[model samples]
Target: MRSLADLNKQGVVSFGEVIVDYISNNKDNTSFKQFIGGATVNVAVRLARKGISSTYLTKLGDDEDGVFVKEELVNEAVNMNECSMTTTKKVCKVYVHQNENGDRIFHSYQNPTPNEWLLDSEINSHIFIDTKVTYFGSGTLFHEKSRRTTETILELAENFHQIIAFDTNIRLKRWESAELCKKTIAAFISRAHIVKMAEDELLFLTNTNSVKEGLAVAVKWAIPYLFVTRGKEGAIALHNQQYISTEGLNVTVVDSTGAGDAFMAAVIETFHDKGLPQSKTDLEELLTYANGVGAKAVTKMGAL
Candidate 1:
C-alpha cells in the first residue's frame, strides 16, 4: 500500500457536501459572515494548505453563496473541475449566541438541500485511479438520493482499492432518526478502512458509555483503525489492536466550529504520509500532531 506522501500529493480526494456556513452574530441580529464549509471539502482544502493536492467533489448551486464558496475553494487550491452544480444554493445557518460570561451557543440549520442533490454523473472510476484515498463526509450519508450517490462513489473507490475513510461528522438533524443514523454509520464502518469519530459519536456507535465497549464494536467490524476525538481532552485511537492516546494542548478557543474537520484532515494526511504507524511511539506522535491541528482550527472562525 502506498502512503499519501508516496503518491506525491496527487492521490487524495474528498467527496461529499460542499456548502456555505452563514455565521450570524447573535449580538447584532443584522450582521453575519459567510464561510465556505462542508466537512469533506474542508479536508481537501486543509490538505491543500498543508502542501498536498486533493480534489473536492460535490454539487453547488449557480447562486451567490455557491459562487462565493467556489471562489474560496479556488483560493484554497482545491480542484474545482470535479465538482458539479444545481439550480438552488444550499447553506447552513449558524447563529452564535453569547452570554455575559462569554459562553457561546450555536444553533445550526442544515438539512436536505441543494448540496444533497449530487449526481452520479459527477463521478467515475477515473477519480480514484490515481487516488490513494476517497474520503466521504457522513453529512451526505443520510439523504436517499445523496446517499445512493455516495455509495456509488465508494463503490468506484473500492474497485480501485483506494483507501476509503469516513468521518462520523454526525449532526443529528441531518438524519431522519437516531436509529437510522446508527444504522447508516455502522454500514459505513463496515465499508471504510479508517473511521474518525467524536467521543459522543463513539458512544452512539458502540451503544455504550464505556470507551472499552465502543472499541469492541471496532473489533467486531474488523475496522483496522479508529480515531476518537475528545475536544480539549485531546484524542485516543485504536490501531490494529494497539491503543494510543495523546494529551491536549492549552489554547484559548475562538470558534470551535470546524475543529473536528481539521483534526480529521490531519489524520488523513498523516495516514497518507506513512500508511499507518508501525509502533506505539509513531501512533502517539500522529495523535499529538492531530491534536495541534484541531486546536489551531478553533482559533479560526470557520472549518477551513
Candidate 2:
C-alpha cells in the first residue's frame, strides 16, 4: 500500500458504468442526440480536461457503443489501462429528457446485459497502486454483481489508504425499493471520506424536510467532507464541524445533464492539487470554484 505522500503524486480512479445518453433535442422530445455519458465517466473526462490524470475503470462490451465510449474517453485524455473489455457486457443506454429550462429528467434506461460487470475476482491492489483518489457513484449498487465489485474496490481503496469519494447519483427506478436504495447508499457513505449529493438526494436519504435538517442528520456519519449541491442556487459544504456555502455562477442553461458530475470533478481536482482544505475559508473557496465548473457544464449540450 502506498503512503499518503506517495499517493499524493498519483491520479484518480473513477469507477462506474459508461452509458450512451440519448438526449432529447427538442421540448417535444422528438429529435435526439447521443453522447458518451454516466456520472463517473463525466467526472473522469472533466478531471482530464482540467489536466488531472484520471483513470476510468469499468467493463465495456466489444460492441459499437462501447467502442464509441472508449474513443471519446481517449479523446479527452482519460486513461483506460485499468478498464476491462468483454464480449458479454453490452453498453448501458439511457434516455434524457430536457425541459425548457434545460434541466434534465432521466426518462428511461435500456440495459441488455445488466448482470455483466467487473467481477470482484478481477480486482487487485495493483489497480490502486498509483491512484490517489477513487471516485464512484450509486448507479452500480442496485445490481448484485456490480454491488459486490463496488464493495471489493472500496475495500481495496481503504487498504491502500486512498481517498474514497462517493456521489449519491440516485436513480430510483434502478432499485427494487426506496428502502433498499437508502440502505445501500448509507452503507457506502459510511465507508467514504468525501461524499457529494444533490440537495434533493440529501433530503431523501435523511428523510428530512430541509437542507439544514438533512445536514444535521448526515453529519452523524462522520464523513470528512460532505457537499450538497443545489442547481443554480449553488452548494453547501460541511467539513470539520464547519458549514460553508457558496453562491452559484450565472450561466445560460443549455443542458444540465452533467453539471453535478462536473462539480464533483472540480472538487476532486482541488483535493488532488492541494490536500483537503483545513479551514472553512478554504473550503468555501473550493466550493465556489466547483460551482463555477458545474455552471459551465450546463452551458453545453453534452455532459462533458
Top candidate by lDDT: 2
TM-score for each predicted model, relative to the true structure:
0.89, 0.95
List, residue by residue over 150-241, the lDDT tens digit for candidate 2: 98898888877888899999999899999999999998998887899999999999999999899999888888899999998899998876
lDDT per model vs. reference: 0.77, 0.88
Q: Pairs clashing in candidate 2? A: none
Report residue 16 deviation for candidate 2 (angstroms). Answer: 0.4
RMSD in order of candidates: 3.1, 1.9
- Tens-digit lDDT string for candidate 1 (27-58): 55456677767778788888988887788887
What is candidate 2's local distance difference test score?
A: 0.88
